[model samples]
Target: MIRSVTMARAVAAALLLLAGAVRADAGATFRAQFGDAFLDRYWALQPDAAIAVGYYRYAARIAVPDAAYRARRLAFLERSIAALRRLPEAGMDAAMRTDGAVLLSQLEQERWSLAEFREWQWNPSLYNVADAFALLLNTPYAPEAERLRTVSQRLTQVPAYYAAARAAIARPVREQVQLAMQQSQGTLDVFGEALERQLAGSALRADERARFLQRLRAARVAVEGYIAFLEALDQRLARDGGGRDFRIGRAAYERLFGYAIQTGVTPDALHARALQEKERLHERMAELADHLWPKYFPDQAPPPERVARIGQLIARLSDNHATPAGFYDEVQALIPRLEDCVRTHQLVDLDPSRPLAVRVTPPYQRGVAMASVNAPGPYDATAKTYFNVTPLDAFTPAQADSFLREYNHWLLQILVIHEAVPGHYVQLVYANKTPSRIKSVFGNGPMIEGWAVYSERMMLESGWDPSPEMELMYSKWLLRVVCNTLLDYGVHVRGMQEDEALRLLRDEAFQSETEARGKWRRAQLSYVQLASYFAGFSAIYDFRESLKQQLGERFDLKKFNDRFLSYGSAPVAVITPLIGAADVSR
Candidate 1:
C-alpha cells in the first residue's frame, strides 16, 4: 500500500510538470487570458450594443456615449490588441484559436472605422439614438416600471445627445442626412404616440410618471430642433457644397472587406466575380423565360431583347401577390409550409416549439429591409424571434404593386426562406447556443447573411416544388444578390450614379422600378453591407465543396451543414481552419 501511494504521487507530479512545461512554452490561450475582460470592456464601451444583445443589467441607466468616450474606446481597443498580440496561438485548440482571430479582426475593423473612416463626421445616422431608447419599450427584458425608467432617463438625455451629435457633424453624407430626418420623424411618433400611451397605462408612481412625461416633452423639442438643423444642413449642402461623396473609396473599401469578408479575397476580386455571376444568372433567367413564354402569352412571340423577355415573365409571376389587407396573413400562412418542407428534407435541425413570431414591422425598422429577422438577443432566453414583414397598407396602389411584384408568390417563399425558417431565424438560434458570447454579438455580416442566401439555393436544390416558375424566380433572386455586390462597388468606388444603378437593376436584375429605386437608396444609405450577401454565400458554398472533395463519399450533407454552423457565426476565414481541424479529427 505504501509503495502504491508513492507511485501515484510520482505520476501526478510528472503530469503537473508537463502542464507547466506546456504553459512555459506558450504564453496563454486567448479565451483563458483575454475573453472575459475583453467582453466586459466591450459591454462597458457600448452598453447600447449590450442591450441589443439581451444584456439588461444596465437597462435603467441611459448612456449617451460622446466623442471623447468614443476616442477612449478606440484607445482601449489598441491596448487590448497589443496585449492579445503577446498571447501566442501555440497553446490554443482549434476553437480557441478561432475566437482569438474573430476578436482581432473585429478590433481592427472598429479601429479603422474610428481612426481612418471617421464615420462619425460623415454619417448622420450615428446621431439616431432613438433605437436605443425605443428598444427599452419594445423588449420585455424587464418589468414595466423598470423599462419605463430607462425610457425616462434616455428621454431626459435627448437634448444632450443631440447637442453632441450636432457638434460632431463636419461633413455629413446627403443620403444619411435625409435618412436620419426620415427616421427622426418615425422616432417622434415613438415618443409622442407610443411612449405617451405606454406611460399613461403603466403602474409607475404618479410623481415618476409626471416627471417622465415632462422629459418626453423635452425630448420632443430636442428631436424637432435636430430635425430643423438637418433641414438647414440639407439646403446649405444642396446649394453650396452638396455634402461629401457617398462612396467610401477603393482603399478604405478594401480595408472594410478584410473585416466584413473574412475570406482572403479582395473587394476588386469579389466585384469582378459578381460581374461574372450576374451575366450567368441573367442567361439562366432568359432560358427560363424562353420556357415560359408560350404559357404566359399563348400566341405572342417572345421578345428579342432578353431584358424585355425576362421582365414580361416576372410580371406574369407578380400577378399572384396578396392584396394590401391580406399581405400579412398570406406571409403568416406561408410559414408552416416552409417549416414542414425543411423538416421533410432533413435540411437542418429545428425545434418546432421554438418561437418564430410573425408581425408587421414597426415604423422605425421599416424602409431599409422590406423583411428582417429580429432574433432573440443572446442574453434573452424567453423572447421570440420576430420575422418583421413591412406592411403595404401605407403605400400607394402603384407603390404596393411594385413592392408586391418584387416579392411575388414564388419570390415570397424565397424571401421567407432567406429571412425566417432555415435562414436568419434558424442560424441565430444556433448562434445563441454557442458558448462564445463574442461570436454571437459581433457576428460576421457576410456569414449571417450569406448562410440565408445559400439556404435559398439549397432549398430549391432539395427538390422543394421544382417548378420552372420557381426556378425563374429563384434565378432572378440570385441576380439580385449578384447585383447587390455589383451596385455597392459601382456606387462607392466605380462612380455609379442613379441612372446607371437603376438601369442595372431593371435591365440586368429584372427588378421593377419600385424595387430598383428602393435598392438605389439602400445602396447609398449603406456601404459594403450589400457585398456580404454574395461574399458570404460564395465563401461558405466554396468551403462546402472543398469539404466534399476532402471527405469524398464520406461527406454527409446534413452533417456537413450542422457541423459548419456549430461554430456560431464566426467569419468564414476563422471558421475554415476549425472545419479543417474537425474534418481531420473525424
Candidate 2:
C-alpha cells in the first residue's frame, strides 16, 4: 500500500511539471500571435512600409491620414506594447527574444515619433507622392495588371489623402513647403513621362487604361492645387518674417538619433567623435596628397603648407572627368572591375546570379542626394538592385563640368564600391538570407550607410589598385563622411549657416564647390541622417577590432564579413551583443 501511494504521488508531480512546461510554451505562442497581430494592424496604418516589405495584402490600399485613425493607432500600439511587456522573457526562445526586442523597439520609437515629433505636421516633403508611386510601378513583383491596379488605386486616393493631410499640418517649415511644391511639379512630370508610358504598355483593357488615365489626370490637378497652396503658405511665412526655421530642434534631433542610430549614445558623443575623425582623416589625406602631388603634377610644385598642398592635390584629382552622356555607361563598365576587386580580395562572397540594374535617377526621386541603391525587398526572393546615378542634364556646360569634377573618375570608382559591390548591395543580399523579418525590414540606417563607407576603406586596405590617386580620393571621401556628420550637427544643433557649412565642406573636407552646395541643401532637407555614416562606421570598426583581438590568428575576414552581414542590419548595439565572441558557430 505504501509503495502504491508513493508511485501515485510521483505520477501526479510528473504530470504537474509537464503541464507547467506546456503552459510556458503556450504563453510564448500567445506572445507571438499578439505580436504578429499588432504588426498587421501597424502595417495597415503604414501601407507604404507594408508594400516595401512585400506585404501584398495591403498593397492596393493607401493609409488615409485620418485624425481619428491616427489616435486609434497610437492607442493600439500602446496597448499592444503593454501586452508584449507582460510576456516574460523566460517564456521566449532565443529567436523570439531577439524578435521581441526588435518589435518592441520599433513600436516604441514609432509611437514616440508620431505622438511627439510629428514630422507629418511640420514637413511638407513627408507627404510627397512620388516615392510612394515609384515603389508601386518599379518593383514588378506582381503581374502587370495587378501592379497597375495598385498604381491606379493610389492615383485615385492621392487627392483625398492630401486633403486629409492638409488638416493635420497646422504649421510647416517654409523651406520644406517650397521644396514640396518644387517636388510636386516633378511628381506630375513622373506621371506624364514615366508612369504614363508604363500604364500604356500594361495588359489592361481599354476601359481600365481609360480609368487609370482619369485618376492620373485627377492626381495631376490635385498636385497642382497643393503646389498653389504651398506657394501661398511660403509667401505668407516670408511676409510674416517666420520663414527662417527648419531645424527639428535639439530635443527631437537627439530622440531621432536614438531611434534611428540605435546606438544608445548621445549626439554630443557622436559630434565629438566626428570632430576628432575629421582631423585624423584630414591628416591622412594631406600625407597621401603630398605623395601624389609630384606623381600627378610633375611640372608644378605642390604648395609648401600642408593645407594648401592637400587642396591642390585633390583639385588635380578632380581633373579627370566623365561627361553626363557617357557617365552612367562608364559606371556600368566599372561595376565589373569593382566585382573583381571584391572577389580577388575575398572581401565577401558574391551570388553571381543576382541581377543589378544601373539607371538614371527619376526626376521626383532627385530631391535628395546624388547616388542611391534600390535593393530588392527581403520577402521577394529574386534580387534586382537598382544603382541610380543622378543626371546632369539641368546644369550648364560650366556647371556640368563642376558636377563631373565633384564626381570625378577615381571618386566615381569609390562610389561604385560604396553602392554596389561589397557595400549596400552585397550587405543587403546577405541580409535577405537572415530569418528575422523585423531586422530585415527595420534595419539600422546608420549601419547601412556606415557599411558602405567602411567598404571604401576596406577596399583600399585590401590593395585596390594600390595607387596614390585612389588612396587620396578615398581619404577625401572619408573626410566628407566625417564632415557630413559634423556639418549636420552644426546646422541643426549649433545653428551653423550656409557659409560655415560651405567652408567646412569645400576648404576643410576638400569637397568641390558643387558638392558643397548640394550638401548644404541636403543638410537643410534632412536631420541626423548624415551623422549615420561616421557614427555607424566607428561602431563597426571598433566591433571588428574586438573580434580581431578575441579571434587572434584564427580571424578570417571573409568569415567575419559574412557572419556580420547575416544579422540582417540590426543596430550595431543589438548585433554586437547578439554576436558574442564566444560563439564561432555559423
Candidate 3:
C-alpha cells in the first residue's frame, strides 16, 4: 500500500510538469501567430500612434481618420477581439495571460471610442498632425538626416489629413474648437523655427534640403488652412450655438470611467470616496496649519473655521515662490535634488543611464497640464524622458504670480516628486524594462497617473522632508488629488457649473484662484481623466497596506515597490490579483 501511494504521487508530479511544458509551448505558438500580427496591423492603421509608441517603421505614413479608415479600424478591432477570444487561455502563463487581457482591453476601448464615444465627430483637437511631425523631429531614435527624410515623406499627407478632419466634424464642442484653434496655431512653430533649426543642423545634401524645405512649406500651408477651418467653425458655433455641449453626461462619464479605470468601483463610489477623502484631508491640513500658526503668524490666533485656517496658512506660504522668469529654471534645479533624495533614502533603485531632461513644454502640446513627463516607449527605453514644464513667459503678470504661488516652494518639491524622480519618470523607467511588450504599449492610464500620485505621499511618509510646512503643503497637494476626482465627476457626471467647481477648488481644496480656473478649463477639455489620480492612488495605497498586513515583518519597501512596478502599467485591478497570487504561492 505504501509503494502504491508513492507511485501515484510520482505520477501526479509528472503530469503537472507535462502540463506546464504544454502551456509554455501553447503560449509561444499564440504569440507567434497572433500577437505579432495584431501589433503590426495596429501600427499600420495608426501610424501616428505607432510613432508615439516607438514603432518608427510607419513614421512616414499618416492615417487620414476618415469614414473608410474608421470602418477598417473597427473591423480590425472586431476581428482581433474575436481571434483573441478563440484562443484557449488554460495553456498561457501568467504574464501572457495579462498581455492578452491588456490587448483585449485596448481593442475594446478603441472600438468603443470609434463607435460609442465618437470623439471624431465632436473633438476638433483629435485632428492635430503637427504634434506627430514635432515628435519625428524631436525624438533621437533615428539619425537627423534619416528622420528628416521621414518628415518629408510624412508632410505629403498633411493636406489630406486635415481635409479629412475638416470633413469629419458634425456638431463639434465649442471648447474643443477653441482648444483646437490654439493648438493648431501653436503647431505652426513646428514648421517655422523648430523645423528650420533641424534643417540647419541636418547633414542633408543641398538638393535634399531644398526639397524638404518645399515639403515643409506645403505642410505649413495645410496647417494654416486647418487653423482657418477651426476659426470659421468657432465663429459659426458662437453665432448659432450649434456646437455640442462639452459636458459628457453621467452615462457617458460612467462608461468612460470604467474604460479609463478598470477597477470594479463605480464612478459614483469613487466620487463619494473623494468627498470623504476631502474632509479627511481637510482635518489633517487644519491640524498641520494649527501646528505652524505660531511660526508664520506668531502674534495672531488661528481662524475659527478649519477652511479659513488652512487657506490663511497656504496663502502666506504661497508668497515664497519663484519669479515668472525663474520658474522654469527653478523646476530644472529641483530634479537633481529629488534624485539625490531618492538615492539617499534608498527608496528605489535609480538608473543613471536613463537621464531626465527638463525642458519648456513644446508649443504644440501646451494649454492643458502645466507639467507632464513624456517617457520613451517600451521599445525605445534608451531615449531621454522629458520633464516638460510650461513656460510662464506667455502669462500676464497677475497670471504668472498666481501660477507661481500655486506651485510654491514646498509644493514644487511635491510636484517634482509627482512628475519626475520616483514618480512618473521612475515608474516609467521600470515599466519600459518590463518583459511583456503588450503591457507597456497598451499601458493603463489610471495605473500610470495613480503611481505618480502615490509617489508624492510615499516620499513624505518615508521621511524625505518631514517639516511641518512641507507636511501642510503636501496635505494641500493631496487635497488637490482628491478634488481632482470631485471636480471631474462633479462637472461631467453631476452637471457642475464653473462657479460651483471653482468654489470646490478654492474653498474646499484651498487651491489658488488661478489654479482653480485652469482646472475648470481642464475638466471641460478632458473627460473622465482627472479621476485617475485619486482612483489609482487609493487602489495602490490600499494594496500596499494589505500586502504589508499579510506579510507582517517580511514586507520590504523597495522590493514591494519594484515588484509592483514590474507589471508594466497594467490596471490596478489586473495587477492586484497577480501580486496576490504570487504572495499566496510564496
Best by TM-score: 3
Provide the overall lDDT of each model, using Cα atoms, as 2-decimal numbers. Answer: 0.83, 0.81, 0.88
Clash counts per candidate, in order, are 1, 0, 0
Per-residue lDDT, model 1, residue 206, is: 95
Tell me the lDDT of model 3 at 394: 84
> Which whole-number lDDT from 0 to 100 does residue 537 have in model 3?
90
TM-score of each: 0.93, 0.92, 0.97
Quote model 3's TM-score.
0.97
TM-score of 1: 0.93
Please state the error at residue 35 of candidate 3 in Å. Answer: 2.8
Cα error, candidate 3, residue 485 (Å)? 0.5
Please identify model 1 stretches exceeding 4 Å from their true place: 1-29, 550-553, 580-586
Off by over 4 Å in 2: 1-27, 34-36, 197-201, 297-301, 582-586
RMSD of each: 3.7, 3.7, 1.9
Candidate 3: misplaced stretches above 4 Å?
A: 10-14, 580-586
Model 3, range 201-310, lDDT digits (tens) per residue? 78999998898888888888998999998899899998988789999999889888888898667998999999898888888888888888999999998889989998
lDDT of 1 by residue, 190-260 (tens): 88776778888999999999999999899889889989999999889898985888888888777787778
lDDT ranking from best candidate downward: 3, 1, 2
Q: For model 3, what is the alpha-carbon lDDT of residue 381?
A: 86
